[model samples]
Target: MDFSTPIMIIGLVAVMLALRVPVGFTLLISGTLGFAMSRGLDSTLQTLGARFYDIGSGYSLSAVPLFLLMGHMAIASGVTDDMFKAARTFVGHIKGSLVLATTFAAVGFAACSGSTTSTTAIFGKVALPEMMRVGVDRRLAAGCIATVGTLAGMIPPSVVLLVYGIIAQESIPRLFIAGIVPGLLTALAFGIMIYVRVMRKPELAPALPPSTRAEKIDAVKSVWAAILLAFIVIGGIYLGVFTPTEAGAMGAAGAFLIALFRGRVTIDAMKNVFIETSKTTSVIFIIMVGALIFTSYLAVSGTSGAVSAWIVGLEVNPGVLVILYLVFMLILGLFIDPISVMFLTVPIFLPPLVRLGLDPIWIGILVTKSLEIGLITPPIGLNAFVLKSVSPGFSFKEIYGGIWWFLQVELIVLAILFSFPELTTWLPDLMYGG
Candidate 1:
């Protein structure tokens, strides 16, 4: 339970993770070992067993698989392509419109899919080429897809937010609502950046011819499924007819029917859907368990409380404290996954922030918004790498270069959200009459 003990455990976990020990097992084994060393094997085993049950039996964890299922069904149903087609029809011909359209489409898709990489990969394949063909700036085009992809967390049914809500014991519905304004603001911010980039250098995003009246109507009609789906899921939740978990279930059910009606659902496809869902779900569960173990280790070593004590001891303004905290996460994100960052740090950080009078739900949005900055950050940019793998022609350097503007825009949005909690909190409050 000494300070040195937590430091040692942290070091061990980092080494194991860096060695590519499966993240789930690395954190689990490392934390278990740390606990055993500090508390004796019998007590450590008891702690581990208790922690496992506590984490597994959590009501909020139930949201993970159901939401994952929702996203998987949405993807398997071929709804993403339809969503993108509708987005392109409306915005494709505008100046840098396809890139902006991809941004627009991603926000809408993320509301349904709730996977950053899903939106990223979907747009990477569907919109990237079209932008390139129209002479869009490669940097801007790739960066737009890479950054916009992160909307999955900012939108409802967000896997990351679900995990955060579960761990923090916050309202998933409130978290969903808290994310809406910031999410839309983020999308709009990206759109504006694209608009400015295109106008400053017109060649970067040349305008497409306007769509015909019939074409515009068809675009609107094609997206009716996604529209109805979003309304049912988000609107229902906002109206309090559904909890986050129930809404996720309903979303999955709706996605399945839509897929079936479209004739895309076959027995084989269903099997694959379940198989894929299990694989993804297993990864999430294991990490959840591992993070549980890690969190326990931090508690046993008293590191969680110590970090907070140290932070609160700082003699700086609270606003500066907020900026410093985000900077710390941004740096850690350079080498860690967002979930890992969330699990490892939240116990220590959030407690102190709340003790300082910050709103937990608003801070939740701020945490995710900060982590989004890390998505395109180097050395550990997961979204950027997702694009790199699919892009045979684009350079990682170029992608990284373009990401600066996206990162800049997101940082500005983060600042706005930090200063004005209403941007992230008003909708949820209004919906609940808080």
Candidate 2:
């Protein structure tokens, strides 16, 4: 095989992926073959070993597992329930208030969990029943749960941003800072979409009896632990009190303390958090190492350079190049998971980004925004499937239909980010001196 050809390497990867091979292995096999074809078997073996050592020992990557541990501990502590309860108490009486509350809960859970699938599943189990009891339309309830769950991806302490930082060689904390405005804007957009939707079509939601002042006070108190936890974790990061890694440690410890205070902590739960963190971290690291190996081959083979030249030679507008890349990402998301998409595309897409002198921080936000849309898109929409798995009673059509307006909201957000690059870069610059 003439591994000198980038297309040949890409084709092999696609075939292996089509056969359902694990992404890590697919990259490893393909990269190793290409490396050997270009630079002999001995050189390929040496490169693979060196790359693994470099990736495994990198200090920045240590943050990955700690953040994962924090998220899992928060979930195990039952903060999701408290957050949802608080949101419900305050917002459950307005038109489509239950849906509004779900969106709020999704944001809170996104803070703790940072996993869209988990947020959707937890809320689908918790919020959907209440929405049903209040006669909220099934399509609207399920769709909101599926779509709004993606708030976590844009929010600070996002695992996706962490991974992107590691790959893009950008600052992790700056990435975290950049996510703040965009995440809140996305959540607000979802809220507005719901309010307008239910208001125009009053049949979709029923107003509940408004809560009394005392009830509202009690609801606020119930969520004090969550508020405090977010402050310690997210606040600490924003205030420069600690690095993201330190914040992760504090967040995990705080989650455990909150769980203990609530009498929800147990040895088994702690054990499960560690076990799950380790599993998730291992998978992420494997994919990353494989991506590094493959990227090394691409660099040595000059394929990346050639692609960069070809893209630049076209003399297209940089904005158009970005839009085309985003469209490609959205289409790819229809078949693959977000992590795989990140690993496969970042290396290929990054060269063009640099050649065009685009800001990586802004590009990072755009990439994440696309991934957010991918989570709700049809076919392989991970969040939608999670909602369906949690509640099989809702038809897929109802669930997909429910997200149409929210999808429009997401598209608007994307356009805004594209038009105003400062929206993504402002906070990071303010905090980090750009």
Candidate 3:
């Protein structure tokens, strides 16, 4: 293999992505080609087989399916209705509070959903219609729904964070704990943004009459199961009562119980949940295995080393390098899905980043943050596409337009995290020790 092999593989993958090929296929083919060229066909096949076997049999990977099932079951249990009701009851009377309620509800749902697409879809069905019926601006409502859903990627039980922990070899529970403050900060920032938008326009969202005392009490009662489940699952992990994988199992079991209590469970529903979970987990795991193979190819070809050395020899400040790294991710996010971006870049960029003496956990959070922002960004924002599909009332332009302010709010939160690494690290350190 020559120096150009890695560049050729990257170019081929980029072309495949441009042609709209699935990311998993793109990585698999490109990596296999590179691996064969660098290490011979027999060795490449053997390495690929070994990598697949290791990833397939890993206990840690079991958490992927469990967490995914927990999200699907949470949706099946109709927790979104309770979440939205409780949030609306608390904040519905304030200006622009419908959107505010949606944001609050998103934070709660994020705990269980751990998926931006599912969270957005659920709210599209649950809250978007209510906001529309209440005469809220469709653009504002749809935009908030789309953007706020990205919170699921940042909150505890986040699949993105979990995958990051696995790839970066960081502690999963610490990653979960580290996300708490940033996730809440994101929700609060979104609420503040909505308030300012409505306060100035006074018509983007119409305030509703306050919930009666009884209504508030009822709402609280309705959401107690969800709250308890989250506390048990996430809190258990934080307290070291269980490993992250065990936490996922507890969460899945709890979601099933909630579905039973809500009378939402049925033979068909369980089958469907299982089917969906299987499909999702399979897709994620396949992509992951492909990433592992591709990364190994890169390693065997000395591509990572060459790239890392090239980056180091740039001789820029470490801070500037970090900025550039983030900027590249943000730009790449405009074109690629989060999972694809993760598989493609983390192996290449992260080794170099850690080589700079930056912390892996912090880089993981930063990468996750960039991916979260990408989900709401223009041109191929998956959450935005999912929103449009679920709520056809808003045009793509309208939905994208509504997202800018929230995007700005997210960027502000990202900047704060960027400026003060302590913000992302504090909780983890306090909980798990440095």
Candidate 4:
């Protein structure tokens, strides 16, 4: 097959993306056209007929909607608010405590939700006002909220990591297990950054009055539902007591119970949650189907293999090659959504890296971390946009200004993960035992 065929298809995808066409449709059109070109219209038509059902019926993919439902239910139950309150109550006495609380709350919410936008939007509404009220610098408050939301990409039940596992054909449970340490470390790094920043510039954030022991205890008690739900969902998976799908189901049910017990589960609220879940799930499946179709075309046309062989023939150092691919993703991430970045690059770059005997699991984590940085990067920072939408007063300059500090911390964490593959791999290896 002529290399031009795949090149033309890629160009078409780029053009469509530049035109702001939806990612799902871009992949669908490009894949269908490319497949038809190489395999004939009849063969392409047959595959299209089967593709939807084949992807839609995937048992593993069912977990996507279930986990999404759990996240939406958690939002409806005011879990995000409780998490922020609890963290603030415990640590409010410290300098930059509100900023610290926001980070802690984000980590807690990440345990429950996988959608970064959802996390950003909720925290923007819930935490931003509180931080502003406490005289925290608007830029710092907004920046921290925007940056921490990316945690959902690395944390357990993360839809991004789940999609990565599906596309890369790695173990989902292992991916989830692998994310735990890096995710926490990222949060810790953010906490440290916040502490140092507030210490150096005291006006950026004001310390809240310390809570009494009883108040702290009460705050902790208030979030018992969130703690229990996270334990049952994440803890169950860690202990091997539940499959990812079963865990998603239990988490969704647990979230609903939390809402129901809290009297937050009105009929209308339930309807809205289900509708939102269906919408998100549908978009994800379309992208997945389209990506699979596109990758199938690459396979049939020998593009993936050809590219892999070409890269291997170069005999470059494996470390440099990995860094190059990561740098490419970081740049692409500046323009595209994280999901699109994964769908576009993984099929092309992952093959050569895997051929080099690098671990796909570790690569998955690194790719995820790169994409997480993209969410807060300049020009097209999606999380920053989300935060701005929720917060009309903060200009892009202020948001990006605050983001710069946390971005440094993120880069440091990314470097650490890259330098020590074991940081990303050890837990999974220990949990599943290589």
Q: How close is candidate 4 to the true structure, as a TM-score?
A: 0.98
Worst 10 residues of 4 by lDDT: 425-434
lDDT, residue 270, candidate 2: 84
Worst 10 residues of 1 by lDDT: 332-341
lDDT agreement with native, every candidate:
0.82, 0.84, 0.88, 0.90
User: Any runs in candidate 2 off by more than 4 Å, and if so which?
Assistant: 1-5, 432-434
Q: Is candidate 1 or candidate 2 better by lDDT?
A: 2
lDDT of 2 by residue, 93-185 (tens): 887788999898888878776666667778888889989998999888888988877888878788888888888888888888889899999
Each model's RMSD to truth, in Å?
1.7, 1.8, 1.2, 1.1
lDDT of 4 by residue, 156-223 (tens): 99999888888888989899989999999999999998999899998999999989999888888879
Per-residue lDDT of 78 in model 1: 79
Q: What is the lDDT of residue 143 in candidate 2?
A: 85
Where does model 4 exceed 4 Å of error? 432-434
Report the Cα lDDT for candidate 3: 0.88
Question: lDDT of candidate 2?
Answer: 0.84
Clashing pairs in 3: none
Q: What is candidate 1's TM-score against the reference?
A: 0.95
* C-alpha TM-score for every candidate: 0.95, 0.96, 0.98, 0.98
lDDT of 1 by residue, 29-90 (tens): 88888888888999888887887797678676776777788888888887777777778788
Over 4 Å off in model 3, which ranges?
432-434
Q: Tell me the tens digit of each residue's lDDT in model 3 across 335-361.
A: 776777888888788887788899888
